[model samples]
Target: MDYFSQSIKQAIRTVPDWPKPGVTFRDITTVLQNKTAFRKLIDAFVHRYHDQHIDAIAAVDARGFIIGSALAYELNASLVLIRKKGKLPFDTLVEDYELEYGTASVELHKDALKPGDKVVLVDDLIATGGTMLAASRLIRRIGAEIVEVAAMIDLPDLGGSDKLRAEGLTVYTVCSFEGE
Candidate 1:
């Protein structure tokens, strides 16, 4: 791995059988705990996006907010949040998607984007791709164009990145873990 990749990998903590059996979860709290590592993580993203004509940063619910908010501040772009169903207070655009176990929904406010707006979707990680895909659809349904989907870590073995690419969406990640 490259130096940056190695650093990011070292910053993450791997937990075994989290929330289920045989699941190796890539926990990013360690990265957040380290000021230098967290800055490095945001700096990598900011460097790539600062020069781009990005109108907004839309992040998936929960962890996505952590990275997305910081990135929005760095890039001076508007921040939009995609949250679980009924989480938003105002009128929302909802998209239902299949999770590994069953169905779930996410919501984005109706006024989050304008037509033809260029947006970058942010998340902590991409696993099965369902959540990211749903976030993309929500952004698109509001008439914004997705420039790319950005994540801190990607589990290629899960096929999430490939699935997003198959739909012609660009996926960018700072580091990747090969297997579960």
Candidate 2:
């Protein structure tokens, strides 16, 4: 494994039965809490797309916000947040998606991007791949060209990257869990 990948695995803390029973939630709070880990994560993401002229970073809501905003600032670009339904105040475009346990709707501001703007998608993790797919749909609907999709961790058993791969999107991650 690469240094970044190793760092991610070392930093992440997995908790069983979090938010419910029999489900393991990959907690990134542990990673974020570390100054070195957080800095390395930002550096890894920055290095991955160093040659790509990203115009903006489109981040999924909640967890995505933390990483996305930082990356946007590093890239000197704007940050677009795709939030849970009806959370955006201005004109918005929305998409619905099915989750492993349920369903959800996400929305983005209508003017988040101009036609053909180069963009990147950011999230903390990819599991089941539903939320990322929904976020990509919202980004495209807003007329942006997705330059890349980035996540901190990938859970392979969920086949999240495969789903995005089938859709022809490049998926990059710092680390992958055992099931992956």
Candidate that would win on lDDT: 1
For residues 4-70, what per-residue lDDT tens digits would candidate 2 score against the true structure?
Answer: 7798789998899978998898899999999999999988998887787989999998999999998
The TM-score obtained by model 2 is: 0.95
Model 1 TM-score, 2 decimals: 0.97
Per-model root-mean-square deviation over C-alphas: 1.0, 1.2
Error of 1 at 177 (Å): 0.5
Tens-digit lDDT string for candidate 1 (52-100): 9999999888999999999999899999999999999999999999976
The per-prediction tally of clashing pairs is 0, 1
Pick the TM-score winner. Answer: 1
